[model samples]
Target: MDSLRHHPIRFHVTHWSDDPFSRGAYSSLLPGGTPEHRRSLGEVLDGKLVLAGEACNPVAPAMTHGAWNDGLRAARIAIEAGARRVLVIGAGFAGLAAARHLREAGIECVVLEARDRLGGRVHSIALGPVWVDEGAAWLQQFNDNPLAIHARQLGLPLRETDFGQPLAAAADGTLPDIDAAWEALRAGIDRSLPLADGVARYLESRDEAVRRATRFALDANLILEACLPLESLSVDALDEEGVGAGDRFLPQGYSQLVAHLAEGLDIRLNRPATAIDWSGDQVRVADESADFCICTVPIGVLRDIHFNPPLPPAQQNALDHLGMGQLEKVVLQFDERWWPVSPSGYLRWYDTPASFGEWLDLTDAVGTPTVAGLIAADALERVFAGRSDEEIALVACEALQAWADALRRL
Candidate 1:
């Protein structure tokens, strides 16, 4: 603590909730909502209008690769429909991917993006000399991940996350039994109840200290993982089919991949599709009409844009049931590295609800003295409710120094 000097040089925080383009980071399966709702969003509407994004992908709904793959899937469907011209809304990975492939397949395509730049949730910003990814930084599940292949082929500098590395537990080295809560989850609980309610069934009987540790585990693992308020998440929110293999991080920022996918494409920036009229043979977005249109906007943004003849009642109901989650990040850039550097692992600081969930030791990842902290779940907004970005960053510096001081005492 005594050795720690100089405040952070600068900081950058994400405002997913404030962005009109993307209402939230990703989709969160709320209580009483089934996975079918996610599938329903991906369904094609009369073969003229198809949706593409991570939200539309049932396999890996929140993954960047999922959006990329689904965009290609949607584009192929549009191409098969004998469409000569296509309109792709939103410039995210899905929309860009769809537009690029459609153009290459002898189809005229124009991309409309609400944002000023490319890469929706896969945003990367320069922090001093190093570039830091604000969202979707990692190519997790590297063994089977398509993005990993792209990174390797491009010769982009990559860092494999050592998932096997043991996390630094509490200062006392005591950890809670989070397995029991997970066991209860696997034992088949009521799906109608919220995730917090389901987890309470088992942890409610434990002591305060144990319960605190267990709560930390839930906040860090499940709540933050789902990026939703525990009270709103479904019991099966974390349910998975197969375990993803190794995870990888891009040292050159994810924007390079976005740029590569977006090369030589006719992309119109700062354009938001006000309405989609798919009623006629030729689909239309306002006055601009195309043979087919692929709407890759986020589910929340879907509620904002008007659709002529309206969407299917079933799809509307399903989308209404699903929730958009908040996952924000702040990159604290310092003059020099003061935090402990590890070979490869997350530096976790335990707290109630875990406002700053976990941090990536960017010293090794980006060759800069920076640590990116993820603020997510219900506590996401609470921490940044009325504070400016600088205020929030200052608070984070305190949190980091506290953790450092704690370690020094040990």
Candidate 2:
């Protein structure tokens, strides 16, 4: 907290579990990522069952907008098929979008969510006077993003923040120039010559000085932004899933977009569809049977679901190949702001590859003395595995202290 000049009073750690409803945070592609898997995932089974989620989206899979688009597509397919009653499972962004569009088209649809509340991954909690998003927080593409469009329409003010700026430097104070090295990396990737397996492998081929200098930033981007480990992320897929120029946060909370999308839709919470009997003419979910059904659950959760006739071998294989990304956030509320106030945010460590390496300055964003520490991939798994909230917080504080010490030395 010394780097930020803030003394934290309380800390809240949110660890999203790989469970019945949401197995992980989002979807990630493996090496040799193919669009065929996504296409197979989105295929309408027997014109009675349709899969709708970010995972089912071929163009923008694992994105909030992609999920919304998939929902729209699924709803349109059911409507065009003259389906009167549609069962939309999981009231996440995709399910909510499908329900909303289905309602607009005057098609009867019921949204069944396992959780008691809506906004699957887009969760927000109040920390004193300000609200902090514990789940999906930022809208990446701003003007062009579908979520941003809905936020603007709902009159939610967006706090635009440039994440490119760094608040703290490396302890050695010999940070390498990333722009030139990044260009070289991109050029190497463009050649499509058998580059190494992952980002870490590709970086290994670079000069020692260049690798050391770019290590911190590059690792941070992979884990924090991509929500995957460098070892698991494919070099080719990295370029394919490019980063957004700027990010916008909903001060009111990202759930507002969910609320807007869910307006007038029949959303039934606390109803987890355990079994689906889609073998006959009518698609059955729980006790209710509809002309068609849209399963918008995450791929991790889908693996466990019981299908009457079972999913096709190709679809099952696709689910097995696609991996879920893990991410955990630790939100700390301080008595006062002790850190430098930056319009964007703070990137703490230069060498740490863990999630806590980057801390978002929520002090200005939420009008409170609070910051969120992120952890993802293998680091998150190792640090948080079998650890309590208190233990996690202690580790996070120690990391912050270490970062503060480094800043002081510089």
The numbered model that scores best in TM-score is 1
Candidate 1 residues 1-410, lDDT tens each?
A: 23435588878888887888888888878776767887888788888998778877767778888888889999999988988999999888899879988988989999988889999888888888999998888886777678788788999998776644524444344555555645544564545556667667756676786667667667766777778877887766767322135777887799999999898999999888989998888998866899889999988788888898799987787787677888888889887888666567467766654667577877877777888887787776678889988888877777677666555666
TM-score of each: 0.92, 0.91
Write candidate 2's Cα lDDT for 1-410 as tens digits. Answer: 23434346788888676555786788876555556777788888888898889887777776788788899999998988889999999999899888888888888999999998898888888877888887878886666678777777778878776766766656556556655656556665433433234345566677878777556656565555556766565454455453455677887678777777788888899999888999999999888899999999988788778999999887887776577888788888877776555556765565545447678777776787888887877778777989888778777766766666667676
Which residue window of length 10 is worst by lDDT in model 2? 190-199
Off by over 4 Å in 1: 1-6, 164-166, 171-173, 177-192, 207-210, 240-244
RMSD of each: 2.6, 2.7
TM-score of 1: 0.92
Q: lDDT of all the models against the reference?
A: 0.78, 0.75
**What is the lDDT, from 0 to 100, of the residue 311 in candidate 2?**
93
